[model samples]
Target: YGAAEAGRDYNTTDMSRQRMYNEYLPPYKAAVEAGVGSVMSSFNDINGIPATANKWLMTDLLRKQWNFLGFVATDYTAINELSAHGLGDDKKVSELALNAGIDMDMVGEIFLRNLAQNIKEGTVKQADVDQACRRVLEAKYRLGLFQDPYHGVSEARAKQVLMQPAFVQAARDVARRSLVLLKNDNQTLPLKNTANIAVIGPLADRPLDMLGNWSGAGDAKQAVSILQGIKNVGGATIRVTYAHGANVTEDAQLIARLNEHGGQLDIDPRPADAQIAEAVAAAQKAEVVVAVVGESQGMTGEAASRADIGLPGRQLDLLKALKATGKPLVVVLC
Candidate 1:
């Protein structure tokens, strides 16, 4: 959050041999030694060649030197984008990648579309293709896929195994451990049951935001939101009020981008000043105010980047308004 100077962007990385081995190769080597089932080549090029078509890095270094017998998969359309990296066309790149060590293609049909042609032209050998296929089949054999691919995968099985007592306890443990409290002075917590508490911000009652990104198989509706937690934890005697003080951001382009895959954040449709006023009013009538703020799930993870990683939208303004109320305020970054 503007804590340091911005570093220069090296769009295409070009590093010396010593730096490559010292910085990057060690981790790959460790993974290989740890018996990793497969390796996915990254999008960026190293030195002068794309990872998808780097024979020195893949075959000679990974397979021969390190004895990594597992198959190497291409990251998304890395093989197809070889041309974009100024390497070659589809057929040419396919040949290069296959010869290099890419046994599996992820999301791109470059190999499926061009491998036969490459073989006919004698650019890729039958032996090389056979080697790749053997490694892939070997992996499948290890997984017992040849016998039964869908073993232990059924509704009845899921019901029997999922969310068992031990798993639930583990989940609770992880949740507790994940919490990072930066500040909590003057015994702000353990709220007095008779106190009137106002919970503010759009995030306070948003169950979807609690699920986070890549919540694989997790249902957002099942999550207990911040408002619910506060109400439940504070018990029956605590009078609580809620106000959606601000949306995650006011930028229309950002909202659209975040919702491109799905609606991770919902903007209030109501005017900003009106929301702030409601929050301020809530704070005015409360003994203590709890403001739920910070990132929506889509603001982080792969392909998501930020130049100024501060509190998004008019949340700062919302906090300022609540602060003006002169009530004891608790800031909770979700």
Candidate 2:
């Protein structure tokens, strides 16, 4: 729920606000109403306010107005976010979180460690502590965890529910509904069957990164790559040539981290000159150069905020080289 970047893909403030109200809020409200026990808020500061301790999201949205009786948990160590989130120091953050009605402090023992001192110092009201603890106890009572703590999950069930086909199909349905066709220019309609088609780009050939960021439920193995899609669109006679024009990122830190995680995008962190030369050569020979350009999977997701989101490294240089080749350039902006 961070603010949309200025002048980028989803940069408008009004668009961002609309997403919060129309997209993210309703499901949460529904979950609370379905007799759900509790909700754990986020670690990242949303709209410059930590969701864990935001008065608007926690007090106004969940408690006072929604009348949610369920307990609220903080995302791991999010209670001590005062120091990291620029709220204040650890002590102030603890007080803020407790007062904000967070019941459980995950990972960070801020409340257990400092609630007493905060009460003595008049930074936190004792009534706030009682209310939070009461909510937690109420949740435990509702779950019957006190009488039967380990009743729901079992090893047999865990193995059997590796992946329920019904669940997978439901997810696919949601994805299909959310799908937006970016371009469908006149009678480019269903692209007539052609024997010669160029499947050229960094992503066109790489299936792994096609799933994009935070693909937790997405089956990477099952998801078809662009190359697979093109092949599926035609028969054996259709010819396809793939060229890895440029890497996903040129940042040294990002490349090192990606390499550490066994990522394919950071294949070779050599100078941009070598990759550009190779792409230029391939583009020069082909009838069309479908150049792929953009950040890596983790580049724009969590902790991936950027002061400048301009094309990474010498990709522009590579594109310029490819353009000089005079082939029909069909850039795939990822």
Best by TM-score: 1
Which digits, one per residue and each the tens of the lDDT, describe model 2 over residues 1-334? 3444453322323335578878877888888788778888776655766777778878888988788888898876778765776788778888888877788899899888999999999989988899888988887788888898886778898667755778668865886697565664443434455445555555676666767777776566766677787677666867766656566666677788865653566355556687677777776665555666766666666555556778776777777888788766666666
RMSD of model 2 against the true structure: 5.3
Q: How many clashes (backbone N, Cα, C below 3 Å) per candidate?
A: 0, 0
**lDDT winner:** 1
TM-score of each: 0.89, 0.69
Query: Ten consecutive residues with minimal summed lDDT in candidate 1?
Result: 1-10
Error of 1 at 294 (Å): 1.5
User: Could you tell me the lDDT of residue 208 within candidate 1?
Assistant: 82
Candidate 2 minimal-lDDT segment of 10 residues: 7-16
TM-score, cand. 1 vs. native: 0.89
Runs in model 1 lying further than 4 Å from the true structure: 1-14, 190-194
lDDT tens digits by residue: candidate 1, 26-118: 877898999999999877676667788899988899989999989999888889988888878999999989988999988899989999999
Q: Estimate every model's Cα lDDT from 0 to 1.
A: 0.84, 0.71
Q: Which stretches of candidate 2 lie over 4 Å from their true place?
A: 2-62, 85-88, 116-130, 140-180, 184-191, 217-223, 232-235, 260-264, 269-291, 316-331
